[model samples]
Target: MKKQSYGMKWLSVEVVVILVGLLFLAPFYFVLTNSFKGFAELLVDTSGLPKSLSWDNYARAWEVLNFPRAFLNSLLITLFSALCMVVAASMAAYRLLRHPSRINRVLFSLFVAAMVVPFQAIMIPLVQVGNWLQFLNSIPGIIFCYTGLGVSFSIFLYHGFMKSIPLEVEEAAVMDGCNPYGIFWRIVFPLLKPMTITVIVLQSLWMWNDFLLPLLVLQKPELQTIQLATNTLFGQYLKQWDLALAALVMGIVPILTFFLVLQKHVIQGITAGAVKG
Candidate 1:
């Protein structure tokens, strides 16, 4: 009777979880169905599928949003920032682990503390510094900003994961006549694959979806990221829902495709990284 009761409880929990998942996905379902719709048909019945499949909305939105340029801009910023963030944080973490000191502990504490400090509190000072440095409205400027903001969290993750890695392997590499740089890049960095993939996935999502920072830094039309370009579709009184929904769908597809392609790696990375330090 106890075994039967436990099985019944498990089934109920699974049903509830499936229902919640469906509820969370309802918005995406609406976006997908309405993206192919005309303005008239969308207003008539948003809950239903489009009367007929159409590409007009997507084509128009693509041209207006300058999809190619926006996509390229987002891609560059995300890739550059993630690469720098991973390399710097991983190295820093490895160094702290290999040679722990009072100063190193204090610095790691500061990085962890900085993560809880709200970005809003630093926005004004950050913008002021950016202006003074003439870093406003530039790709390199925003990429720099993303790297700074992402470093703390990335370091924290790396520090924990690196602790879990046995130090004996690194010591063996040193005995084999590997230099410090060679030991880190060829031996240590490769072993950090799981955490590196985790950091890349997390940072890419933030950098790609980030709107406010890009909005502040990128004023030129040519430099606008995908989110900024999409914002242009909104007006004070009227919204181009048909075009807006189409743009949203287009925006989601690329990231969705990215996640789908790397999903196995993402899962493995997160699972492995979660193993205790």
Candidate 2:
């Protein structure tokens, strides 16, 4: 009777979880289904599926948004920023570990503190600095901004994960005549793979989806990221709902596909990162 009772409890939990999952997925269903609909049909019944599957909205959005260019811009910015953040954060974290100092403590504390300080607090000053540095309206400009914004949290994650790494392995590598650089790249970095993947996934998502920073930095339409391009569909008076929805669906598909592909790695990375922190 106890065994049967446990089985029934587990089944109930599973059913509840399935229902919640469907509930969360409901918005995605509406967006996807309505993306195929005309403005009129969508207004009539958004909850219902499209009367007829049509790619008209998608085609219009694609042309107006200049999806190809925006996609390339977003991809470049995300990949570059993610790569830089991973390398710089991992190295900074490792160095702090290797050479523990009062300064290192202060630095780590600053990084941690920065995580709590909202971006809005610093955005105005950041923009001023960017302008002074001549980093405005350029890909390199926004990439630099992303690096600064992402690096703090990345360092925190890497630092925590670094704590779980056995120091003796690095010591062994050093004793074998490996220089500091070689010791880090060859021995230590490979071990940081899980956390590194986590950082990459996180930074990529942030940079790819980020609109505000890119908007402030890259003002030119030619250099617009996907988010910026999508925002153009929203006029002051009349919003293009069909085009906007289609663009949203388009934007969502790429990241969703990316996450699905690397979801296992992401899960493993998060688990491994949490184990140390």
Candidate 3:
């Protein structure tokens, strides 16, 4: 009797958790299904699946949004920015960990402190600086901005895990006549793979999905990121629900595919960091 009761309780809990997950996923389902429906059908029944599959909405949205260009722009920006941030941050973290000087300590603290500073507070000043630097509407400019903003948190995560790496390994490499750069590149960097993967995955997602920064930085229609392109589907008086939804689906696909593929590494990276620390 007690075994049966416990099984029932477990089943109930599982069902509840499933229901919660469904609740969170409901919006995505609505967007995906409605994207295939006609305007009239969408208005009549937002929740139900479309009576007939229609590819026109996606086709029209792709052309109107210039999705191919937007996708490429987003891909380039995100990939470059994330790569720069991970490499720079990892090197910085490694140096800070190995050196451990007062100045490095102060800088590390500042990086941690900067994480708490809201972007809104400094957005105006950042924009002004970008304008002064002629980075106002350039991809490289946007990449530089993302690299700077991402460094603090990335450094923090890298720094924490770097301490777990044994100093003996670096010292042995040094004794073998390896320079600092050589030692870091060959020995330390390989040890940092897990944290590096973590940083790459997390930062890539942020850069790929980022809307506001790209919107402010890239003015040319040809340079707009996927998020910016998707926003163009909605106007002041008229919102193309079908097109908007289609664009949204397109925007999410790449990141979703990336995450699905690297999910194992991502989880392993995170767990390794936790265990090592």
Q: What is the C-alpha lDDT of each candidate?
A: 0.89, 0.89, 0.89
Candidate 3 root-mean-square deviation in Å: 1.7
Model 1, range 191-270, lDDT digits (tens) per residue? 88878988898889888989989988889999989898889889999889898888888878887888778778778776
State which candidate, 2 or 3, has the greater TM-score: 2
Which residues of candidate 2, in runs, are more than 4 Å off?
none
Clashing pairs in 3: none
Clashes of 1: 0
Worst 10 residues of 3 by lDDT: 268-277
Q: What tens digits encode model 2's per-residue C-alpha lDDT throughout 1-277?
A: 9999999999999999999999999999988998999999989998998889999999999999999999999999999999989889999998886788999999989999989999899999999999999999999888888999989999988887888878889889888899999988999899988888888887787788888899889989999999999999888998888998999999988988887788788787777667652
Error (Å) of candidate 1 at residue 240 is 0.9
Q: Sort every candidate by lDDT, greatest first.
A: 3, 2, 1
Better of 1 and 3 by TM-score: 1
Q: How does model 3 score by TM-score?
A: 0.94
Model 1 TM-score? 0.97
